[model samples]
Target: MKKHLSIFKLKPLSMLCFTFLILISSCKKEESDPNEQLQDGNSTVITDLAGDTQAAMGSATPGKEARPFYIFLFRLKDQKQIWIRNATDSAQWLKGKDWDLAFTGPYNSEVYVNDKKYRYNPGFEGNAESAVVMLEQQYDLVDQAPSDQVFDASTITKIGWASSASANGWFFYSLSTHIMQAIPNRTYAIRLPDGKYAKLQLINAYKGNPPSVTDLNWPAPYFTFKYYVQQNGSKNLKTK
Candidate 1:
């Protein structure tokens, strides 16, 4: 007991008060309450889970599938999609062996209320010459080409969107490559949320997971890929 000289056994003063309260909670700096995130209305982290906000930007959905795509008539408000090129309508484009020709039904899409019939089912192809080069390069669709316009290889037309979403804003096609390889194809980074990241790929594909030399992989198949991204200007991501 004569050796007891401890002042409440202070183990170096409780390790310097637990390292000074963890450096004062790591420099106590918290005051970014910008109206608490403008009233906390958040939701934007899907950089393409097949990203389909039903074609954002005001999102009408009066029947769906209306996203910038046109040719000829340009001024705004156009999303046609009629059919019936010819089962006898003079054998126009409705005749096929591998692709093309009145591919979708004929009519009655709810009594054609503002028309919208992107037929060509099964894999899609309503006169698919790359779908008329993505509907005649709707306002240069950001980056489009297939001979940049003038695709009248004997046509008939049923229509395919346009007149809005920022001057004909829709173009997606992939017979295997080009069009920036089809949006974040393999996706190595896409994080976004302030931390920052967006990198995407597919511009030429051929890097890996790809076999079968050129038939594009199975049974003479050729659908390639497609993509779309329009954040801020109204979050649109046509994830391929």
Candidate 2:
């Protein structure tokens, strides 16, 4: 009888040890690898502006000079990779025909995407197919209170003009004597040629610090922003 009891206790202890080993192996397999993350589609990216100082708007004569503009090419879902380019002239812009977004600059504030012009309009809803709408204010960086705002299609209207030179054009940049601002809180909604929707927000234009007249050559034209592109062909910004 004593021998039989010892045998039963040994069996239960052996099973318990086997179960613990299996649990540990399962946990090791479930660990996430950062290197396997997606590089382009359905992911957010930040990049610097690409252009020479000679192409700046106020750097030289207006019509005689070319304004620096950055072009971003987002590949289609069926494609393999993303193509990005930066240009300072019409010829350069022509080379980037596949681009989905444009950051037109001298000051590097205006943004054009999907072959349509956009502006910061506080009152209007931002969701027209042919229009670009953004709010005309800046929110605190740490707070990020504007992220909660709802965005969708049909809430926007097309502005009359193309560039900032016109009276009724989209005014995305704000500059004053004492202060210059980019209205960072504004979020833009756009529909791509591929029938996809995306939401973008401009984070910063300068590299180390905000632009100043005295500090022109501190490695400027760096553009940083966060974007979410809907992968399922839905107009809803939250679907991403």
Best by TM-score: 2
Residue pairs in candidate 1 whose N, alpha carbon or C atoms collide under 3 angstroms: 68-169, 69-161, 69-162, 93-101, 181-202, 181-203
In model 1, which regions exceed 4 Å deviation?
A: 1-115, 118-226, 234-240
Q: Local error of candidate 2 at 199, Å? A: 0.3
Residue 151 miss distance in model 1 (angstroms): 15
The Cα local distance difference test for each model comes to 0.25, 0.43
For lDDT, the strongest prediction is: 2
Residue 15's lDDT within candidate 1 is: 62
lDDT of 1 by residue, 200-222 (tens): 22122222212223433222111
Cα RMSD for predicted model 1: 20.2
* 1-240 per-residue lDDT for model 2 (tens digits): 996566456777776876687787666545532112212344475545432333444545543345443333333333212322433433333233345554443443444453432343211132322234454433122112122223333344432222353232333343333122344345566566455666565555556324233443445455545566677776555422
